[model samples]
Target: MVDIPVELPAGPETVTGDWTVGDREDIVLIAHGAGAGKDHPFLVGLADALGAEGLSTLRFNFPYVEKGRRMPGPAAHAIATWNAVVAWARTQEPSARVWATGKSYGGRMASMAVAEGLVVDGLAYLGYPLHAPGKPEKPRAEHLPVIATPQLFIEGTNDPFIQPLEQFETVVSTCQNARVAWVDGGGHSFEVKGQKRPAAEIGASFARVIAEFIRG
Candidate 1:
């Protein structure tokens, strides 16, 4: 594991990341959600599982998280952070294909960054927050249509952020190359109802799903 300091041009703040080398040429740069840092158990589990599947992984903290703030910073900062991390990842393995994957807010920001002209081979959303809880009328999906890269949205049926299933379906339809993987009874964190499991176990199960998508 190599510690990387991501320097942002705006605040000049340094965000930290942990890089886990894998045997595959496909590299994934993952970011955390609003409430957790890159070292969150769920993300660590996911990174480990992906590494086992032969995909290199880089998990990084957002600027606010690095500062120990519970609330996330503005979208611009998150986008810049994504840019910095992806840029640094490219330097590590120039021949490797880099994909962007994130949980919730992190995923959404990745999409936004891609729409704003960030380069990535593909994208995966662990659990996209289509809209704020109980605010379906204000869906955050205007940028999905412009993102031409292949995308996989792993969502839970019980996620309040994307309720009334049809809404999410409609939003995905606008994308040129996007698909959904519905997790039965799963919440925003991919936790299934009444099915207790360790965070790592749950993350491992999704590794195959994501790897298959990347391979396709």
Candidate 2:
């Protein structure tokens, strides 16, 4: 139940994070998806699971969430928020490594930040939206090739955000220290029809995959 204190930039209101820090261990700073906040059940479950694996986690909300908007903030705003979070993470545990990760839009922004030279040890995208559904021609992976940090991208097979599996595989193969984990029969939200598993369980599976990927 440890709180990961953070300081936001002067213009934006201060933000707090729900954090679970592993004993003397490094941390993974995570941002929620477009429709959820830091306390979303899925995020909480993932943080708990990652904590069990001896990895600390810091999950926070974006500015849009702070404003109670259904949509996320602009790309530049998200990147700015991430930049602040990373800066906070570094100060909180100077000796511990800091990793940036997120779900969907959050994840993509983290990648963008990394490509722009925002410092971090690595990255993990719970679901990297390659492109909007029915829009494969406008994929969002061009900058991926330039990012050098170790990265893990977990995605559902049926996610509308990313198209045909073949192309996704090819893109991942081109990035250094990057790999993909597929969640069978999962939609963009990782929901599998008729499967009784709770949202928290699905998130735990993602946490497990990320833990294993980082361990390797």
Candidate 3:
């Protein structure tokens, strides 16, 4: 476990993280989505799988989640947390390559941070919310094209957040280096209708694809 300090407008806050050491030279720093924290089974399973794959994993919470808030504090705060976590990770194993990834909101924040010049080798999004469901008029993609690092988008074919796949495809097309891995018939959390599976199991399933993307 680690405590990462983030300076928010209100005051300085500390976020918590769990580091699972692996036998590899690459370090994957993961952030939680809007709802969950570092310990969620979904994230835990992913980290555990990464460990088995010999990839170091560090899962951490944003400032808001650390403070027990249901909603994210602010994009700036989340970005600061990303900055802190990445810096901390680099310090721990300066020779290790660092990659950033997270579920939905957490992953989006990472892109924003990278766009704003937070250094990271690459990024992977578990599920990117292209737009609010049914409202593709506005997109949160302006900064994506500016990011030069390799990016991997693991999206579910049936996720409402990216409803109207064509628009999402266009956004990806603009990226400097990005690719998508679609989950056939899966939902936002990779939940396939009529198929019952624990969140951890579902999360763990994505490990191989994500690991491949990282090493690619």
Give the per-residue lDDT digits (tens) of candidate 3, residues 1-216: 878787777888888999888854899998888888888888999999988899999999997777788998779999999999999888888988999999999999999999999999999999998888888998899999999999999999999889889999999999999999999998889899999999999989988988898787
Ranking by TM-score: 3, 1, 2
The top-ranked prediction according to lDDT is: 3
Q: Over the stretch 1-216, how does candidate 1's per-residue lDDT look in tens digits?
A: 454555565547777888888954899998999998888888889999999899899899888987889999889889888888888888988888999999999999999999999999999999999999999999999999999999999999999999979999999999999999999999998888889988778877788888999888
TM-score versus the correct structure, for each prediction: 0.96, 0.91, 0.97
Off by over 4 Å in 2: 1-10
Ranking by lDDT: 3, 1, 2
Of the two candidates 1 and 2, the one with more favorable lDDT, higher being better, is 1
Q: Where does candidate 1 have its weakest 10-residue lDDT segment?
A: 2-11
RMSD of 2: 2.3
Task: Please identify model 1 stretches exceeding 4 Å from their true place.
Answer: 1-9
Record all residue pairs in model 3 with backbone atoms less than 3 Å apart, i.e. clashing: none
Please, what is the whole-model Cα lDDT of each candidate in the order they appear? Answer: 0.89, 0.82, 0.90
Maximum-TM-score candidate: 3
